[model samples]
Target: MDKQTSRNLWRITAGQRLRYASAIAVTGLASAFMLSVPLVGGYVLDVVDTQDLAQGAALLVEAANTLAVEIGGKPYVAYLVLSAVAGVGLTALGATCQYLQGRWAAIASEALARRLRETMYERMQHLPASFFDEADTGDLVQRCSSDVETVRVFLSSQVVQIGRSILLLSVLTPILFARDARLASLALVLMPFIIAGAYYFFAKVREQFKITDESEGALTARLQENLTGIRVVRAFARQAYEVEHFGSKSLALRDNRERLNRLSGAYWAVSDFLCTAQVCIVLIAGGMFLAAGSLSVGELFAFMMQVTMVIWPVRHLGQVLNESGKAMVSLGRINHVLLAEEESRDPAPATERVRGELVLENVTVEYEPDRPVLKDLSVHIPAGETVGIVGPPGAGKSTLIRLLARLYEPQHGRILIDGLDLLEVDRHWLRRQLGIVMQDPFLYSRTVADNLRVARADVNDTEMMAAAREAAVHDAIVGFPAGYRSRVGERGVTLSGGQRQRLALARALLVEPPILVLDDALSAVDTGTEGQIMAALERRRGRHTTIIIAHRLSSVRGADRILVLEQGRLIQEGTHATLAATSGPYRRLCEIQGALDEAIERDLKETSNAV
Candidate 1:
């Protein structure tokens, strides 16, 4: 692992490291007891020989006497019986300790994963809106959920197993050397090969795991896009095209995963062969030494059993390395998100509550560096003034509203509410005082009442119904079987377009903000409903500042002043009657909409007469 990744891992797992260490210590102690069982069994066998019964009996008595003296002068038979019982007791105790070790290890690992996921989610919430514009939702979900799980498996199982293997190797190596140096030297010959093979595969495996993870993320993105756009796909009859696209991504993921598995399998196969050959060499050498009078039968038996213990862990070490490689890749992916730049929340205090007055002075904005969306725009509205904005398709109508909301900061000039600069105002305080409904409003899959109460959770039912009535959607809502308590489905799919817009408008109105912005919010509703909503707003005149943007000229005909925009510049400004009287963009728009409305009225009358 690189130094940065190591540091990040240590920081994430800092609180749980001590617990993991204690588990490893307990496991090592248990292993020590388990390793001694073979030695005891070998000693018992050496003391019993059938060919020389009298001599064997003498040897047994002598061994019993030595053990009895060691235990403070008990009888020889008593010593033998105690030794037999102690062996079984030690085995059971070791098993119990092993269980405890696993319990502690799991606790530490799960705690680390929980902390990491919470921290990542919190960071994602605070990130700047622009960061999400370029990021794939599916990829982020994979990193937050799947990648964290992979790292958890490594910490909980692979790390613990590796530690145990190292402990056994460290404690058993010396005993093997002391018994027969030549045989131990022969066994050590395979260690260098195993180490070199592991080192060689580590880099390759890490790269492959990274590629596989990326492929999986791409597949997830494809699936997410298809599901989100399912309605459009069905309307256009493109189900076959979507299925083919999804299948291609799935196939790529599968291929990458298979390649990673093959590489890991090859490493394990080589490691296993080396371990098996090492054990065979040790057994054959010990047999030769016994025949040549350089080794005893009992000593050879003990050496064979201990040699297997030392070599098997070395074989499993390759598997641990493979898993660790994947974990390192996943950790890197998670860190990328945690380190993104967050939205700025400067410490600018407000001494007084904001009034409805707003001013934009030479405010300029550009999503790209060289292509400006709004240029040299300036406007002012005193408290409680009703203003309307009309513009062409590429004009700066929406951009102006976004700037006032502080959704995007301008590159030059400033926006002030009352007399304070927006850049120096607390963002949360500023947003809370302004209620906005966008051209494409979004609603949650919740009941009608629940959605309306989102802007002000403490609002009473009477207040909610009043707001719904103002948006001209109250009667329709009550027509449903469950009324305000009915489910709207995902993204308000169960509601009509006009119903969704009015509900969104009602949600904003429930807040009773000091400033309300409706950016073409009523386009989906018919002219009759639009007239009713406007009449309701007229009753609210002088209560708060209202800014309306609309393509339909009639919607804004009663405004105190209307501003017309062309390209990115404000071309004209006047009252609706004055703009309609002149020959400008506003007058031309009014004429065009007037003709369309007449044609619609004539068609309705003709259809009625025919019926």
Candidate 2:
């Protein structure tokens, strides 16, 4: 791994690295005991075959002679029994170590999984909003979930297996050479080929796995978007079309995954044949040495056993390589998110109140290069004033609100509140002081009271009722089946458009921010309820600064001043009546709306007379 990717993996494995190390150590200990079994088996056969012991049997001779007398059997028979007992004991100890290693690995893997999830989520919260502008939520969720799982699987199994493979090769190869160098050399003739095959398999499968993973992410994204807009699809009677679209995504995922499966089948085929062939060559050569009288049958038996032990793990090397390939790809995907730049950290401010005075001086904001959304826009609104903004589509109205919230920064100018530069102060504090309700507000799947109290935890019944009343939603909330405790479905789907908007308004109101922005927020409400909400704000006149953005001329008519914008420039500024009396965009809008309303009223009157 590169230095940065290794660091990311290590950082995520924090709090559990010690446990993983311990597990690996136990695995090494287990390999030692397990490798001794072949020696015990050969010694047992040698004892049963000969009365004279080998040179290494001085210790065996003493124990066998004493046990022979006690058991009343031949010395070789007694030695055979001792060798059997030793082999069984070694196997038992190996099994115990294996159990301990598994237990530790399971615990450590779970911890690593949790740490990874937490790091990804916390990083997302700090990432600047720009990172998600063109990002897919489904792909992000896949990386956080499915990709993390792939890494966890590799850590729990393949990481330890790597150590085991190295230990096996280091220890077993020398022992084989000591017994018979010629046969050992012959046994290893295929090792280079296996290594080369494993490398090729990993290289091919890694790309296939990456393609499959990304295809799955796209399918997930398609599924998520469909579900979120299911009602839109049904209303338009596009079930057949949607199903066909989903099928295409699903088919793409299947094709990518199928390629991975096919590659795996070929890898296993070649690896299985090579491993089996290597073991057969060792056994055949050892039998020839025994026939030449240079090796005994018992010694030959031991050679076969040891050779099999080496071959088994070498075969398993393919699986370990497979998991490593997957793990590297998954870790890279997760690091992509962790490496993004985060917004400025929230800091303690010099004071609590902002005074709600905002100024924009020659501001220029752009989402793309050479294409500014707002150009040379200058405006000033002092504390305790009521203002309305009117604009044609793409005229930078919503961009202005996003700037005030610090969601986006102006490319070439400065914005100030209470004479403090926005970039200099803390962004979190700035957002907290401004309460904004968008045209389509979002609510949690929670109770009515919970939604209203979401901004502040200390809210009580009195404050909830007061805020709801101000937004003209108190009675509606009380009439629900469970009143304040009634659960609103996801995104408040159970509520009507007006109710959702009003509930969102109440939610913002409960925070009691110094500046309130309604970006077409009150559009869904009936005209009467809109008047009630406007009147409520009117009563609090000098207590807060309110900015309203609306298409309806009547909505902005009551404001102290109205500003009209077109194509990223402010074209008119005056009170509603004053703007209406002059010939401009505002007057033209009023005339068009007036004609439409008059025609509707005249049609209604004619129908009534006929009735």
On lDDT, the leading prediction is: 2
For candidate 1, which ten residues in a row score worst on lDDT? Answer: 48-57
Report, for every candidate in turn, its global Cα lDDT versus the true structure. 0.85, 0.87
Candidate 2 — which residues are off by over 4 angstroms? 51-64, 71-77, 346-348, 602-611
Residue-wise lDDT of candidate 2 within 414-503, one digit each (tens)? 998999988888888898898899889999999998888788889999999999999999999999999999999988989999999999
Clashing pairs in 1: none
Across 1-611, the per-residue lDDT of candidate 1 in tens digits comes to 88999898888889898988988888898888787766655554554422222222344456566777887765445434655765687788788879888899899989989988999999997887788889899999899989999999989988888898899889889988987889888878898898788877877899999999998998898888888789999999999999998999999999999999889888888888888888888888888998898976667777887888788877677778888899999999999888887778866555545678999899888998878888888989999999999998879888888778777799998998888788888777788878898877888888988888789889898998999999999999999999999989888888888889899989998887889899999899998999999999899998879999999887899999999988778889999999999999999998899999999999999999999
How well does each candidate superpose onto the true structure, as a TM-score? 0.91, 0.96
Runs in model 1 lying further than 4 Å from the true structure: 48-87
RMSD of each: 3.6, 2.0
